[model samples]
Target: MNTYKQIEAEILAASNILITAHKSADGDSVGSSLGLLHFIEKLGKKATICHPDKAPDFLDFLDLSHIITMDQEPEKVNTAFQEADLIFCLDYNSTDRVGKDMTPLLESASCTKIMIDHHLDPQDFASITVSDTSASSTAELIVELIELSENGSLLDEKIGTPLYVGILTDTGSFRFNSVKPRTHEVLAILLAGGVKHYMIHEMLNDTNTASRLRLQGFAMSEKMEILDVNSVAIISLTKGELEKYQYKKGDTDSLANLALSIKGMKVAIVLSERDGIIKISFRSKGKVNPVNALAANHFDGGGHANAAGGMCELSMDETLDKMKALVPEYFPVQ
Candidate 1:
């Protein structure tokens, strides 16, 4: 029997439920939360979705009007946190990932906490946890939960659409090493259940403004640097450049991956200056687990093995230099 059979029973017993993902919401986090929201509502339970802040504008088509963002509606989020009998934390490994403003509320909430995540070394905060580092995405694990629910018919269009988006984005459209045969199997089922693949692809990748494209071009031409000796590439963007280009939240979503497209590049780093901090993203190839070892040890961040993110209080130059220096230590050149 599936381990989630116990979680299914817990879901059946709960009344008011609250769902949440990490701050600076990504497609996987948003998709998993909304997908689970639809599923819980189908079970006739009062379910509410909340995020520490707003999601990206590109995700507006997912019917997220029901989601309560603490940045926008703090009082409502507070009320929901207080009233919920069960709280589902998705995608993030720690309560700190939910933002400082949200940490206190979550810490005080007298509810059963359930964590469903695909990250490494999760803190023991949740009462129940379904953590698998090998899973492609949290949405994939959520599907496992749904199948174990006895009512397997719950994987319909409403639930499948966001789940598909989660898996698609986290797996880099099914190109990442984490994507197993079962990942493709789940995707096939979602497609058969009415996930509009071509349309979603267009909306996510093709629906970009001219300024966004120009910004990417400028970053590649002027800001990108190659360290051939270490097989690493770096792209740094300043706050002034972002303002000049009319940058939006998701503007740099594909920048790191773009650098990785180079033939000999084994690792790509993107450093963007924001709010007096340098935000860092690390993408690596092969067995060099940046998320588990490099990001955790140096940058105070962790995620998947190949893709991870971190932040530093240093200037862009200092951060870039630090990352360049660490490459040899984490991923020595052959």
Candidate 2:
């Protein structure tokens, strides 16, 4: 069994700490970091969150606005990291996903390192690793860590909100296959601590802007392509198209899942251009492991069996050709 006392002892001994999460900063990453930040601050320690990219607008409600884009400036981040007595990596198993740009900070942090994540096949990089794929979200682990450290009673509304958001998003509003009864139990405890569920729901689902809705419509109507006898659905969007639609952030999050609405479709892929790189999001249902497909293609990415992601350096057409060739290996003919 894994223990948290060592981590707790390190935290207690450290005077300064730096918290970080994976790139693209999803709700789970942001929420877990903020949740831990609140707890560490309560213990009278200085904690700073440094992420690889800015979080989506919906997550702005988490009181993390100040820390949202800290990852943009590498030199500033390195200065903080160098001075920290400890570094906590939350919701990510690998340093690569933490942000390609922050590699130096991660390598140079002269502090006790800890990693907390729920992803399968976590890379052994930190001094202490607390990973359980069974957990719904890293926020859940943060809650457990807090309780184990006898800090559960210290949770407040600020911390509760982000923790609830992580649970809500990763479980797909409790609809994903990962939604176990214990997940509900954890959520119940968070709510009892004054977490507002409706606000989180609204922030995640109800706050879409007009441009984002238009972008979704365009992606569904024109960008979506069905291949392999309806087994795969691909949606591609260019940066110019997104800019034309005045896309804010987090607009394309649901594009992959939207293809799942099609009957008999087993896999969905969303390919979008971001700063000259092709970002791919993969989702599968039952027995279809998109991560395997991604890994086989020389793309460094992974996630749950039902959802995975990666990137390719090729253009849209070239990337599609590779995906078309690679996807069929995992989804064979019936």
The candidate maximizing TM-score is: 1
Angstrom error at residue 309, model 1: 0.6
RMSD of 1: 1.3
Alpha carbon RMSD to native, model 2: 1.8
Tell me the deviation in Å of residue 72 in model 2.
3.4
lDDT of each residue in 1-334, candidate 2, tens digit only = 2478777778878988899888888889888899888888888888888898889887888877547354467676777787888999898888787776786678777678899998888988898999998998999888778766756788777777888888888876776777778788888878888888887787778778898899999999999889856388889898898898987768898887788768888888899988788988887777644454464356667787777778889988898888788766767666
- Which of the numbered candidates is closest to the native, going by highest lDDT? 1
Query: TM-score of predicted model 2?
Result: 0.94
Model 1 misplacement above 4 A: 289-291
Error of 2 at 251 (Å): 0.6
Clashes of 1: 0
Q: Which stretches of model 2 miss by more than 4 angstroms?
A: 66-71, 228-230, 289-297
lDDT of 1 at 16: 88
